[model samples]
Target: MAGLVRWDGFSADPRRTEVAGVRASDGDRETAVEALREAYADGRLDRTEFDRRSQAALSATLLGEFAPLLQDLEAPAPAALSVRDEAVRRYRRETRDARNAVLTVGTMTTGIWGATSVFNGDVYFFWPIFPILGVGVGWLMQVVNRGQRIEHHERRIARRLGRRRDADREDDGDA
Candidate 1:
């Protein structure tokens, strides 16, 4: 009666209250093993220590067992940010290239027009508009394409996250 706790007519077991005593799943063991691998790769653990810890990780049956194996190691960086950053950098580079293309075309057309007017001492026609419009339209297309690419990238990331969430839910259900 002293240690008993009831919820909706169901008694809670005191022995199950500690999370550290929980059993580790295969996935947890894999994660600990991966961390050990990273630590070894980062030179935090030598070959012999890595091999020993790796064996321990594979043979571990409780979450508490992984504590010693990963205690000295730093967590690996998240992969999502690196991928997103690279995509953003590529987009920015493409945007800069598009802007440069427009600027170059505009400058060349204006230069040709100015030289013609200076040499002839008369303005015959607005012939530069054709090339400007042509290049402008092409650049516009590139901008539109870039926007689409960004949208596509966003959708792809969303889909990937969705899949990951679904996978996590499935794992939870199994647990």
Candidate 2:
């Protein structure tokens, strides 16, 4: 009767708290190994400790067994640019390119027109306006598109903020 204790929903043993027999994926092992490498690089772990932990991580079968190797270390944050930041950067680049295209097109068209008039001994026709018009229309389209993109990103940010506020309200209700 002592050994046949009634098992409840929760376990008293700390070891029993961990999920047993849950296999670690290759990605999980790689992440743990990478963390160990970073710990070594940051002088948190020496060469021998890094090697030992890395080996353990690579050879680990269960997810539970891998925890001890990286328990003391903090996971490194992802080194990715945020979507909004990247969008802003792309918008800036497109604006710059549009401006440069306009400048180049204007200069070339004006130069060709001037040279033709000079050679013909008559400054009568202003045919450069055609190419300039074409380039101007294209540049105008780019500006409009850029504006729309900025507005879209702004709306998306606002929606994200709204969602966060809603989540906070839900959390407060729970509390």
Candidate 3:
């Protein structure tokens, strides 16, 4: 018969022998324990299973052993992707708002200029051009600085995430 297959912690593929053979460190073991604690706190694991896994994690001696512990649990997402997504979202929103404001102000000024020209019985020398030009220039600047603005926005998001991560670590430490 073929070799019996088992659901290893990381995946079904047993070819991870290379990584599994590497020795685990104390910090790695503690990290696994933390993951288990989080899983248990989130109600992903029952008391009995959480206790079992927690013990196993504490005793694990290979880095590969930690993989199986995480397989059934959802892990946190990559920070870069989340931060990029947020920055893009913010950029799009701000660009849209700026565009809308430019359009709205231009339309209102044009309408006023038309009304004033009619009341004066002649063309009023296109006075709406100044306001439109100013708003248009402001929006043009925004568009031109899109890359820098997005980076600045991303930095802000990352800082906020850092603070939240620190807070979570404190909470986790307490737990």
Candidate 4:
């Protein structure tokens, strides 16, 4: 028949001209990233080239893939300085809060231990040594935890900056 075929049965009829892995919606980003990774692994791209292409793909949305779609959903100008300032301020505040909390805990524990040793007539053990050890251990743990937290924050910021840089490149390229 020359007319459009209507499916009346449940049996599947697969078409041969299908592009197997190319999806046409926003949901396709993950699939496309996986495909790009596979392509890179297959020796189709060198490290630098693969990284460039992967970053490009990661930063682009399905809507940004075509010129028409690109024109329709143009992003606003980035507030780079504002973002950087806010990030810095936030990091400082977080670090300060952590430092204060850790020091407070260490101070309170040492004071309580010192008072107990003095009141119980065991001031011999209240010498500088064990209190220093206790405070040192507390401070060490706090610094380690703070380091982890700061590292995590840094990674998050780096990812955001990486994405923003790609966006800036795209904007410049389009201009």
Candidate 5:
């Protein structure tokens, strides 16, 4: 139990002592259960054993409880560059956020401009155009850099995974 690694394969349990019990998060339990499910699907465990392990994973309250449940199973290596689905979704979401910001600024500025012209006897000044143009330039730049931005996103993921593997190796050495 000294060097027990989590299902994520990146970190080790710091201690196995009763006084130093590390509490498990809901995410920890879910990860353990997911690993168990994969093992069950691969026929590595029989139905009864799978059910028992899955239940234990779900009910676990401490990090130590999870170590034993997944000690024998291997963690899957994350794909280095296959962030297509998530990366695209994130990219689209980012673009939407920028669009929303632009829309909000444009609407507010235009309304203010209209109010000033009507109620203050001010001359018609299309001042909203300046701010809108500024934000619009940023949005245009983002769209133009779409491919490089996506590639950069993918590389960040790949680098994180590479670091995880290195950490796992160091943990194994400690064990």
Candidate 6:
């Protein structure tokens, strides 16, 4: 008896007004259509207007088809999250190579020059190069390490964004 209720007006019960298992909200297609039908039955809308709108709504097959009515629903534009990932990868590599080069050069230079400098303590200028080298190497290593750390952080952010994008693509593909 409840399912065969009178068609004079829309039902107040939430269960009777469901669309795709989602409760029919005020602006929902099912509720709106039911209300329109009720209005027409009550002589609120003429035959011409009701038929025109019902046809328009039913004819919309895709989300874009309802573009005019749902102007507020804006689809996200494509972005280049991979570019940030590439940049992060490149900077990380550069920093790593720069750091290795500094270490290699410092070790080799110190081994060969240190022996010679110890033998010639008379040359005050030669000893100064060791302190200078130490400072220079330390500063360069610090810079490279700092840059690598920053790049590592950027890579993490890029990876997260990339995963979200890939997930979105997968969802779209399935749909």
Top model number, TM-score: 3
* Model 4 lDDT per residue over 7-108, tens place: 111011112123222333443444345445444544455678657665664565442332221112222233433544544544555565556665776677
Better of 3 and 6 by TM-score: 3
- The all-Cα superposition gives candidate 3 an RMSD in Å to the true structure of 19.2
Measured against the true structure, the TM-scores of the candidates, in listed sequence, are 0.38, 0.39, 0.52, 0.31, 0.51, 0.27
Pairs in clash, predicted candidate 1: none
C-alpha lDDT (0 to 100) for residue 89 of candidate 4: 47
Steric clash count of candidate 1: 0
Model 6 misplacement above 4 A: 1-81, 118-175
RMSD after CA superposition, every candidate: 18.8, 17.6, 19.2, 18.8, 12.3, 25.9
lDDT of 1: 0.64
Q: Model 2: per-residue lDDT, tens digit, 1-175?
A: 1111111111221124355456767866776676676567556789899889999879987766665676576533442446576456556655766777878888998999899889999995788788778877877887888867766766764674476567669769999
For residue 77, model 4's alpha carbon misses the true position, in angstroms, by 16
Error of 6 at 68 (Å): 58
Report the Cα lDDT for residue 131, model 5.
98
Least accurate stretch of 10 residues (summed lDDT) in model 6? 1-10
Candidate with more favorable, higher lDDT: 2 or 5 = 5
Q: What is residue 110's positional error in candidate 3, in angstroms?
A: 0.6
Worst-scoring 10-residue span by lDDT in model 2:
1-10
How many backbone clashes does every candidate have? 0, 0, 2, 0, 0, 0
